[model samples]
Target: MEKPAELQAANYDLVARDTKSVGAYVKSGAPYVWVTAAAISVAFIITVALLLLTAARGLPHFWPADLVQATYKEPGKEQQHLLAEIRSSEEVTTARLLNAGLPVDEKQPLYDRLLLKIANRDLGGVDFRYVLSDWLVERSQPKDATVLERMEWGNFHGFVVALKEGDKVVASGEEAWKGYQERQDRVNDLRGKVRDIEKGKIGAVNYDLERLRLQQRRLELDGKTPERNAADFAAIEAKRKSENEKYEVLRTELDQLNAEMGRDALVMKTVDGQEVTLPLSKLIQGYRPNDMGLFPKIGFFLGAIWHFVSEEPREANTEGGIFPAIFGTVMMVMIMSVIVTPFGILAALYLREYAKQGPLTQAIRIAVNNLAGVPSIVFGMFGLGFFVYFVGANIDKALYQEGLPSPTFGTPGILWASLTLALLTLPVVIVATEEGLARIPRSIREASLALGATKAETLWKVVLPMASPAMMTGLILAIARAAGEVAPLMLVGVVKLAPSLPLDGNVPFVHFERKFMHLGFHIYDVGFQSPNVEAARPLVYATAFLLVLVILLLNLSAIRIRNKLRERYKALEH
Candidate 1:
């Protein structure tokens, strides 16, 4: 063998030759290579932009008052049916009105003219004309009223009574008036009672003292003035306690009565103002059933967009405005990145730095490459069987016996989905990081070693810093892969509509056992399960676009981080 110095010189010459050849190829900028690279980059950017645009279009709008009003218009058939029902009602005097239309006394003629005017004029396209109960018509002057005005003013009962029973009409009107008068009287009486109670409470102590003094004087006059003994004192104390209890009971009753009176007054005021009666609980039950047309569409569009960007907390679904899928996807990606990055980098380091160029390492390299080629669905199956059923079941049994049958960790959830994805991405990350590690100069590592640095120290202080750009590149690739993964997540965690959010105000805030929605699944659901096909098609496109955009964003962030790392390590490149 040649001397060690000579052997070192030969190795250096070989490295120099390889570097020169690589530099020449890079400078040449072959047409095919440049074209392919530019095409890919442009396609990726266009795809991402399209996705974002699609998601934005999917967002709901909530504006323009006219649209809202138009949506509330009843369906045509329903309107016609309501009109027919009103016309057929017995309250309407079809024959008499027809006769009056021909010719009659001035008052009868006026009634005919008014009826004709209302019948001819469209009540703002409101199909059903009110037919007032006979009572309402009798209460008003005969020739001056229109049913539309009565219905619009919350006189439905009066309108119906006027139409149906003429005798009952008079009775109902009198009863309504009487009821109103009685309620008003009761309200006034309660108000007076409350005022009196307030005054009594203020003067109560003085009144009690006077009464006690009068009793003491009576006892003295009767020559029965008791000694200041314990029994006599107890008797006086008991009397005082009884009086105090009576006063307290009276005050509580007065307060309760006052509250009831206030509520009644509110109701009466609302009725007088012609406000539609609706219970507070019913009002808060959900969105109003009537469509406000354009406004609701607009609101839905904006709401969808807000749901897209707000990192969908759990409350997104409950009150019906938020979405949690976007948040879960992001969270899964972050967790996957944490699990894959370091392990990938270390594996790559061993392969590129410490491993010998032998059959064993080469075989390992082939296996890793083949792992990446394995179908993603197969990986999902493996994960489900091994991680979810096997490992998770054991964990559930050991840690959550009390919550048995209701599994804690023994389900396919966000956690399992994330881990499954990490495994699926491991090969990609390893290959990328290995390629990066290979690009690093061997001379730099050797130089560090020569400076009396241990192998670990050299890797930590020198090799790692120089290779950081490559490591970031690997991470970016991993993020891109993880973000777009849907098939695996479907089997693992994704659901149609989870009743509760994964993160809530429960004991353990983040309930990983909970299923989650995903944009991919949303698209699928809309396309396949939506009741209205035509209406849902556009929504499918919108959801698909959003899913694509999310993946693009992750890739873009990774690119940015890689670029920053490149800048930081630029000095070391030489």
Candidate 2:
């Protein structure tokens, strides 16, 4: 074979020529690099486009749009004057409009139509109307046009005809608007007082009364006759009487506030020429949108967004805010994190550091991976059967014998829902933590051992601290998955509406036994199950955006923690 150096040079040249061939380049994954980059770019673009679309559709809903006053005349129907907001515009084929019996030009291929929010739903029996743009005449925004945000009915659009105290007219015309504002402020103050009495004092008294009842029932179940426990019974009765007196006082105050609020009325004349007498109690707010300036509209828009995130849902979950769902979602995720972290860490430690390395260990790892892929609803069913029906039933039977029929812990509630999610996300945490444990250098363990440290001490002080970042990574992933899980929450605990939150001012305040609302389920309920499809559509997008934001916040927190841990332990890795 010639000299060894010459032979190696010949082989290198042959290899270089082979690698330069198209087949070799393809086999080396050189072409795949561009393909992979293109795929990633496409995915990123799609994600950005989706977020922009969601923001476009959802963010504009809060803006106070100008009210349009127009005269609409159809081919065979009477001409009608309309006071409404143009909700949207669409282009429709001329032939389609003709088929729908709308008069349109045959020569034109397409005609524009305006979707108007005719908000006097009570009178029109519908909230929206679609009319050909060509049929609308004399379109203008009237300066005196008023829009009422009402507690009942969707909305009311009209002119402020008069303001009255009971049946007597107090003000009319321009004076009516000022008088109406004063009366509305008074009503708002009264409403605040009424809510304070009802939700604060009345709620507390109710809690006390219920607790006393439960105590008496428990004593009865303990075979302690009223005669034998006369003092205990008397104490409960005395407490009940005290709470009842408080309730009566609050109730009376609430009634007085209601009467005062109802005394004032607004006489509004609609575009249809019918005058409606609306009680001040029914009106949330009234604004002349057409008269609003840019700054005023911006303020109104911000106020609307705040209300959406702060108030509770109303009108079949279509018309109001969704604070309850947001609260419940956050609370459930927090509880699940608290429960899953320790269990996941312990299980991962056993698998990676303590368990015998064998076929059994390999099989167990395979099983944990498979568990992560199981449908989340299956975990819900398991939680229902094992946690609720079995464990919760036992707890209720043992501790809450007096409330046996009511089934406190035995029902689907926040606790069961959290447990279900914890189980669902457990596999992710185990895998992540195991990978973290595997990454720790063996020399670090040996060094600790040589320094006369026990295995447990070394693991506790050195290994776990370094692996903490991975644990946080797993938690971030878990939170992302848990916050958006609607199917399992539906089976476990989430409801259409929760009258009271799980955590409130009641005694033993954190009530895990209470069923609660969730944002994912709220989105589903409003988007697909509401009676008013058009009204609920924007809310669906809004709720979805809120849910995404919540997940992002939770993940960001976890990621920040993970980054800190990584930085703290970066030197140890060397």
> Which candidate achieves the best lDDT against the true structure?
2
Pairs clashing in candidate 2?
Answer: none
For 1-574, candidate 2 gives per-residue lDDT tens digits of 4679988999999999988798988988978999999999999999778777777788788888899999998778899999989989999998898898776779999988898888998998988888888889999998999999998789999999899999899999889988998899899888888877877788888888888899999999888877898999999999999888888888888888899989999999998789999999988888988899999999999999999999989999998899999999999999999999999999999999999999999999999999999998899889999999999999999999888799999999999999999999999999999899999999999999999999999999999999999999889889999999998888888999998899988879899999999999999999999988888888988898888889989999999999999999999999
Give the lDDT of residue 128 in candidate 1. Answer: 27
Residues 1-574, candidate 1, lDDT per residue (tens digit)? 6579988999999878866796666766775698999999999999778766765555422111110110112222221211111222243344565554522233432221111011211222332243323212212122111121111211121111111121222223234333433554565576567656654552454456545555554455546645745465457667777777878787787879766564421111111123232111111111211223566757754654564455222211211222566766777788788988888888998998889989999999999999988888887888788878888889977765545576667888888887898889888888888887777788888888888999999888887877877877777878877777777877888787655566754345677777776666666766787553433554566566667768878888888888887888888768
Q: RMSD in Å for candidate 2, one decimal? A: 3.5
On TM-score, the leading prediction is 2
Question: Model 1 misses residue 288 by how many Å?
Answer: 14
